[model samples]
Target: MAAVLLTGTGVTWTYVASGGHRFDVADAPDAPVAVVFGAETKTPYLTGRLETTIALVKAGKVRSVLVSGNAAGSSGNETRAMTSYLLTHGVPMAEVVVDPYGVDTYDTCARAVQVYGLRRALLVTQPYHLPRAVSLCRSLGMDADGVNAQCACGGVNLFVNEAREWFATVLALKNAIWHRAPGVASLPH
Candidate 1:
């Protein structure tokens, strides 16, 4: 029992340590393309993350920024709203691209890999959300890194979100193995 407990604790620590999130962009050469996934519409944490990614684009670290998120409403697309916000903040409109159908993490990574032909990316989201996103992206063949949004929602939100990620991870893995759509490779540009 003690051994089991210790092993579980170690595993938990590894996940937590990897999930704390880091925003400082690492060095990249040649492969400067990135895809920034969107968060909730009005969350400061999400907006702050979008801004950081835009700054990277503005600084020329990212040559292309693929904005993927909910874009179903008539009022505005979340990804487009993010792009517009970035443009207002000095990121060129030409640098921004949109994936209008990415309503979830699995779908977002799928779109990035299949539709955009993403070979690598810096997955940006909150700390608690990073591990699943990075893991899923990598599972789909993206040489993925992570950058974090600010953690303004506190510890309880973190705990709940992390718990939710376990289910997400399982679902994503299953989908990747058994439920993936055909023709992802042959889709026309």
Candidate 2:
């Protein structure tokens, strides 16, 4: 158990560290799409990501914004809320796309490549999550770079997010290598 933990820690650190200078939307690479993975709708983390993406859109840094999140059909559609927020906030509706199937970061990364047809993209998310999220998206064959949004959630929320990210980093690494399935072609017709 100790060896496993140590190895996971080492791998995680190496991967995350590769993106050490990642921060802020100003430094993000210009891509056709800014892929903003979803979190709590009203949380500063998600909202800030949206705001950054919107600014990027207005600045002509990116041509479109892809808001990826939980669909949960009509009952729990985070994508709907996110799309609505982006549209209301001055992002052109034609430029605000949603990935309703992106229930998690891994799914978001994969779908961005397969479903959304993104070869290169700018990823936006909270700072604590930027490293792993950027790492996973890149490993999944996206020419992906990232910018961390400023987060306002704290205390237990912060602790839980960082803690969950540790294990999630490991899983993301695994999926990075072995997640090939029917892929985008297999989606229901």
Candidate 3:
């Protein structure tokens, strides 16, 4: 048990450390696109990510925004909600790309490379998630940098997400090693 726990911790730390840097909006480097990972629609997680993508676009740090998420169906579609949010918040429709089958971090990164042909991207997510996201994208052959999205998030939910990242990081390492293609096809807009 001790070995297992320590291994998980080690993997998490190395995985995150491998991500290199996490930038703030003001200091983020230019990239071809800002890839916003999906979260529950209407929540602080989703809102913060979308807002950061908007900022990146407005600042001309990225030429486009790629909103990737699980849009499994018409009801509660994350891709639709994310696209709508960006369009309403001053990001022009022409500059927004949508990937409705992102479903998870690995899939999102895989699709970003395999489907969208992205050589570089700015990953936008919350602090707790940015490292894994950046690492996954980089491992999949994209030159990925990350920008942490600000959010008024806390309490049980934040705690849960932080704790969950330990396990998620391990999975990320495995996925990176395997280099499997994503299950779904490109649903880019």
Better of 2 and 3 by lDDT: 3
Error of 2 at 99 (Å): 0.8
Q: What overall lDDT goes with each candidate model?
A: 0.67, 0.76, 0.86
**Pairs of colliding residues, candidate 1:** none
Find the candidate with the highest TM-score and give its number: 3
Enumerate clash totals for all models, in the order shown. 0, 0, 0
Query: Each model's TM-score?
Result: 0.74, 0.86, 0.90
Q: Name model 3 segments beyond 4 Å from true.
A: 6-19, 73-75, 185-189
lDDT of 2 by residue, 6-92 (tens): 548746663664455465677666789889988866677777888878877877889988988876633346777788888898888
Instruction: Estimate the lDDT of model 2.
Output: 0.76
- Model 3 — which ten-residue stretch has the worst lDDT? 10-19
Tens digits of per-residue lDDT, candidate 1, 1-189, equal 864554455345435534533356544222466677777666665687787686567567678888887776333467767778778888777877888777778788888888889987777777666766766677677777777655467577667777766555555556555647522212123
Candidate 1 regions with alpha-carbon error over 4 angstroms: 1-23, 26-30, 73-76, 155-159, 182-189
Q: Supply the global lDDT for candidate 3.
A: 0.86
Candidate 2: residue pairs that collide? none
